[model samples]
Target: MFKTAKKLFTSLKFNYFSLFIISLVAIGLFSFMYDSVKQETYELHEFKISPKTIRSLKTIEDTVKTEQEKRRIENEVTPFYQFDEEVSKTRQAIAASLFDFIIEEKKANIPDPENPDKLVKSRSEQIEEVRNKFKKLEKEEPGLRLTDEAIASLLTAEVSDLTKMKQEIVSIIGEELSKPVRSEDLSAVRYEVERKLRSSEAVPPAELQTMITLGRSLVVETETINKELTDKRIEEEKNAVEPTRILQGQVIVREGQFIDSEIYRQLELTGLLTNQSSYKPMIGLILYVLFVSAIIYLHFATWRTDNYQKKKSLLIAIAVFFILVIIMKLLSLIDKEFDVQVAFLFPTALAPLLVKLLLNERLAYMMTIVTAATAGIMLLEGFSAIMQMEIALYILFGGVISIYLLGNNGRRSNILRTSLVVSVSNILFVAFYLQMTQSTYDLSELSFYLIAAFASGILSGALTIGLMPFFESFFGILSDMRLIELSNPNHPLLKKVLTETPGTYHHSVMVANLADAACESVGANGLLARVGSYYHDIGKTVRPNFFIENQHGNLNPHDELPPEKSRDIIIAHATDGAELLTKHKMPREIIDIARQHHGTSFLKFFFVKAKELGQDVIEDDFRYPGPKPQTKEIAIISIADSVEAAVRTIKEPTPDKIAKLVNSIITSKLNDGQFDECELSMKELRKVERVICETLNGFYHSRIEYPE
Candidate 1:
């Protein structure tokens, strides 16, 4: 069952599908966190303004207050009035015409004492004539009629009094009509005209009463309300009242204070009332996750590694990413429940340190960004958006520092040193941000942040140190530290090989030097190549004398055995070394080097010997079992191994001889199709050849003999 599961997991389809599932899980976790913080809230009861002041949590305009203010301003606005000059002129003309007609009638009807021939009428006839003329004039002009008594009183007056009264009444009517007269002010204006007429003794009471009646009719409302102007004034007042704005982070209600209507409204506006449900948060989380996933995918697509290593690297990165996210979420929950300032205490740099140590640095940096973003999302609930961003940047700065300081993971103490550096950097960053924001200089608050920064760094180091081994072991990752540990001469496997096959050990060391130099020149992993070379010949320990390197005084062990037996013994070293390395739990990369360094090359000497002895020896039967080198380091090790063995046989090694020997060995390997599976380009192969030739030339340079 375990083997079947292993096979399924190792398959390409299964690995990709598993990656997809992991991505889905990551997005799902983020969405879950978003929902936890931004879920729907509902107010159970209504509230009103009574005994407490109501403040707003979020900035919003008070539409209710604005509307009420508009109404009040509208009520205070005075109605607009306009005077009609045409109405006043028409009324004056009618009054003057009435007086003129009365005077003319009086003149025509009065008895003439100087001329008896003239038709002189009595006072009654004159009054009747004036009444008849008034009736006619009333028909022509509607508001000009008067009573017979008023006409008689006007006729009995002296000519000068009559003229003065006519002028006075006409002037009074014109004066009253010129002023603004609303419908309600008509009677008052008529009374004012009667008062003026009564003050004058030149006019009789009946005439004054008649003049007052005429003034009432003449004082029609000349001014009307201008609705456009009145409404404009009210609108201007409404606009003048500024909208009330509530700032972000402003306190909505104090503790133990009654909730008011405006406070409740603000709570609703800020989504604190919890009555609204929305899918935006969930959608945003999904989009954010997808963006991160796309970046991861792009990194993988662009990475230059073998399929197996690429799969492993991706899996490790995903695992680290989720682990950091979980830690952030946990810290967020604690911060929310305890109301403590512990959110910054999260060890955000832990994942980046682990990734950098156990995986590649570029992948580590990518995971650092992802982890910081996740931390920001987690801290968004209790802090303002600006604060959340600052927290995220804080995490990013610390993570970057950890990655940079921990680049060389040769010793375990580097982790602690990196933590210290990260802590200092975090503290400095916090100090800078605080100073820029001009926050209160409360020592307690500053100390809390400083402590959190220190704790975050130290905790990150501790966690990374503790968890790195597990990740390396579980993922079968061969980190630099693990490689250094394996390279230690005190290791049991290396000690055994040193004791059992001392000559082979010396040969391995020489080969390691050559391979390390060649690999370093081409930008491959020099340490890995050197370490793999150290254990490549461990299988030679089982039969030390059978190998030419370990044989002393040319014992001719191969001469005593048949060609087939010799080939089997020789080929067994590759498999034997692989098995031993695997048993010792060495990295797969080093084990692969042990298994593939020989690369199925034929044992030509033994094959020639067997053919001369009349034995039908198949060439394939004399080859070492090999999967070939699978990386540039392993491939360089294969070439270096052959070059070192060949160069050791040279009696008088010269620079020209060493270069020829190195080129021959590389040519043989190329002809044997040893580098087919790896991603080494032709240009890189040429570079490797040149580097190996140069290194071998230096190793076997001609030396001047000292005269002894």
Candidate 2:
């Protein structure tokens, strides 16, 4: 069953399809989780009693109320009226024409018929003549029409009073005509003219009364309703009216309260009514999940490594991602349901910390970004866009902090310490966000956010401590912490090597130091190399006297055996060590290093000895069975293992001789194609050569002569 599952997961298709399935699950998770349509359905009838309160799951504009407000403001705006300057001038001209006719009649004084020099007409006779002439003139000019009473009063008034009255009447007519006098306001404008005439005192009371009547007639409605300007002004006011928004989580109706038209409309608008589900949000969520999945796939593609290609490693990352996302979703749901900001309490750093511990740092950074984005999306229903962005950035910063703090230190104490520092970072981030986004900080809000921030970090540490063992066990992951524990001297495997083969144990320790330093020089897993080197010779414990490392000064067991037998014994140790590590449930990487360190290099000494004995010998018979070193660390340990064993044979070691020996062994490994399967570059190989030589010189340097 395990083999079949492994074969199925190893396929490239499985990787792509796994990502597709994850995207689908994510879309479904966001679609149905806390959606308003999934809530209890409410009745749509108006004026009915509500059984329960309903809140909006998403923000939406209340279009009905917005339109009603627009209409109301449109109605409240007064219509625009335009004044007619031409009408004012024409009315004033008519009043002027009447006064001009009276003046012209006065100017046309006729000579007396009885006496040439003296006027023969009586004052009454002259007045009657003037009135008759004015009547004739009034027929010629239609605008000169006035009451006979006003005409007679004007003629009887003093000339100065007449001039003043004419000037006042013309001035009042022009002023009133210039104003915006709509037909509805014409009566008011006429009353205003009469008040002006009475106040003016331009003539006697009787003449003023007569002038008031004439002034009212002279005033005409000179203003008209401007439909274009009126409509434009109303439109401007309507645009200024802000649309009423139905915010998410706002109550639509209270329990046992009447559901009026507005409340019912709001419920329908928010999709709380039965059978009113909208698939728009679901579509958006699907697209979002696809986008995130594509980015994750590209990240993996760019840095494709054998570790990431393993199904278990990929599964561990996926598990961490889903765990963090689920926690975020649950917290967001609580925040929405209780109207609190509990979502801010989510352990945002959990994903990055776990991934960093189990995987590489680059993958940890990817986990940080993806989890932060998912948190932002999950809280979209509960927070504003700016607030969501701030939370996302905060989560991002926290994840980065966690990853950095746990750098190659996956021990429990280090994890907790890193988490404490992450908590401090979280607190600082929240404080900064509050200071930037808020005008007057609410003490309650600040306190809640701070508590959530601090707790989130501690919870991340706790949950990581709880879940790490499961991941390590289920996935057979070789974390740094596990490697450290396995490297302890008290471990059963290491103890077995020490008691049964003390010489081999000492040799293994020396090889470990050499491999660890060389591995680190080339940016490989040095701890894995060191720990793997310790157990690499565990197979020698099976027949302690057979191998020279465990032989000490004792007779070699291979002396009694044939050359082929000796070669087989030497070759069997690689397979034997692999079996022991497998039995002890050691990591695959350590087991591979032990099994492939010797590679297929021929045992030259045994083969030459067999040939010298006049026996038929094949080259293949003297070779160690190997799959070759398949990683940089395994290859480095292979070179280091041979270099350490060979360097011990030197009687008078110096830096120059150690350098020559290291280079020859590396070149021989290269010629034998032992490192062909790994990705160790020539530049890195040279670096490894230099590091090993330096380390050997330190170990085997000439000591100062001491007086005895």
Candidate 3:
């Protein structure tokens, strides 16, 4: 059943379709993460009761509130006004000209002190002439206007009163003109001038009114609103107001609470209003999924990785990816619903552990990064960026630790030890992350996260243990764990060989040691070679007396039969062992080793015996079935098997003898084309010869001489 499934998955059409299906399912699952914040729409109104809570789907600037704040700041800014020195100078000059004209007219009315011949005019006539001249000046300078009564007073008053009026009017105009005088404050300026004139008592009562009227006329509007400066100030203040932001996951409206205008606007701003739908998130999610898919596809398609070339490997990779992604998605949902940090309880190391055990470590490391990235993206909406980073790093580091701790041994104890180490590492990672990111720690939350971390490790180990067998069976994989199980002495096949053919069992054990060491030197699957060696001689148990190893001192069964019968019995063992293994549902690799270890080598003893007896015989008939060793492990086992059997025939074994024998056997196998189907390079073959010689020398080493 498993073989059929493996064959089905291996089909090129099925591989493409399976990848498509996996990608589709992954995108579908991830769509929920992208659309997680699509809350139910509301028909809420201002000052009405809200039926349900509404949260922001994404972070966005609250433009309405921000604009309101900007406007308020702008209104509060004082309008800018600039002082006009030109206006002050002009006003003062006009007032001085008016006063100087009055003084000139007064001087002309009297005779000059130095010139007695100058014409002296009457006071009435002088006042008439000054009024006529001032009237003309007023027409020329609008700001210099004065009433007829003020002008008559200026001319008719005493010289002291005239002097006081001119000085007071010019001083008042200068003082008032120096400061900003807007059109709107012209009345205030006139009243101020009257008060100053009244308080000073500088001018006589008759001329005081004249001074007041003249002071008001001198103080024309000196300051105007500087429109550019006023606008610039408003803009500067408006820009200083920070923008209001509605953060993602912020609650816009709470259930059973009043929905005010602000809340209604927030709901609309965040797209929580009725009939609002945004496809941007969905589009972004599709792009992200495609990117991840493309990365995986590129690794498998372009890289020269050994396992990547196989379709079953692709299936296993996709399977592990789906498992981790789905598990993380479920954990994210649980964390959301429970409001607890259940994300820390995710089986972060499970994907890497399973992949490392079933396939290569490089692919395991790749899956670790992919899994962590997927988890981060899935939880980004629900968690803060710091927390998201923590989760991703936790998965990444935990996976690396698990891969290293798993080693190459897949024993139960080793897995348990790895889980315990992972648990401790997880606790330390959580504590460190929290300490670094959080300003203050909550004891309960920290303890919960730590506990979740420990539980995640334990859970990952438990799940890996439980699922390993299922995956191994489903994929027809011969994992290290399975090889260890098959290598046990108590196994039915090994026990059968031990009880039925003790000598063959002993010989098989020696061959197992030799093959295991040789394959390891050449970087092959040493455990597989050892386990295959254990069951290689199971067929010898069927006719235990016929084979020489199992014959012990019993009469040789081959001596009683014809050489043809003996040759048939010897060649039948290879096929018989293959049949037995196949019937027991053994792994294909072990069965292949059992079937092809001999590589059609000529049984020279049997063939030579037939030739000496003058019996008809063909060279092909003397050889075992010709399906030679097809892998490095099988090829090494074949050489080791022949070397070990040949070495046992040496009466006086030595390291030199064993070395020479190991080299000779490997060279003969090479010349006979037995290693042609296997990928054993010449360098690797040399290493194998040295390792086999060392192992055999150890086994056959002479013991220290002792007194009896």
Give candidate 2's TM-score: 0.81
Candidate 1 ranges with C-alpha deviation above 4 Å: 1-4, 27-250, 259-311, 336-340, 381-387, 408-414, 701-708
lDDT of 1 by residue, 347-372 (tens): 85797888888877898888888778
Q: Candidate 1 vs candidate 2: which has greater lDDT?
A: 2
lDDT of 3 by residue, 1-708 (tens): 977965665564634754775577556656655644234466767789988877776688999889989988887887777778787777667776776777888766776779965658765676677777678667867667666667666766667666666677778777877888887888898888878888877777766667777777676777887899999889888878888999877877789899887787787787777757666656766766777777777666655533324556777888888777778777767776764567788887898888988888888999999888777766553525223777888888888999999988888778878888899999999889777866675778777988999998888788888888988898778888899889889999999999999988998989899899998887788999999999887878778888878776668988888888999899888889999999999987888888999988889998899999998889889998959887899899898889988988998899998888888888899998998987999999999999988888788889988999
Ranked by TM-score, the better of candidates 2 and 3 is 3
Query: What shift in Å separates residue 273 of candidate 2 from its native position after superposition?
Result: 2.7
lDDT of 2 by residue, 9-94 (tens): 66657467557656665665565343522334555578888888677776889888899999899879998888778988887776
Q: What Cα-based lDDT does every candidate model obtain? A: 0.78, 0.80, 0.80
Candidate 1 Cα lDDT to native: 0.78
Model 2: residue 100 alpha-carbon error in angstroms: 7.4
Candidate 1 clashes: the total is 5
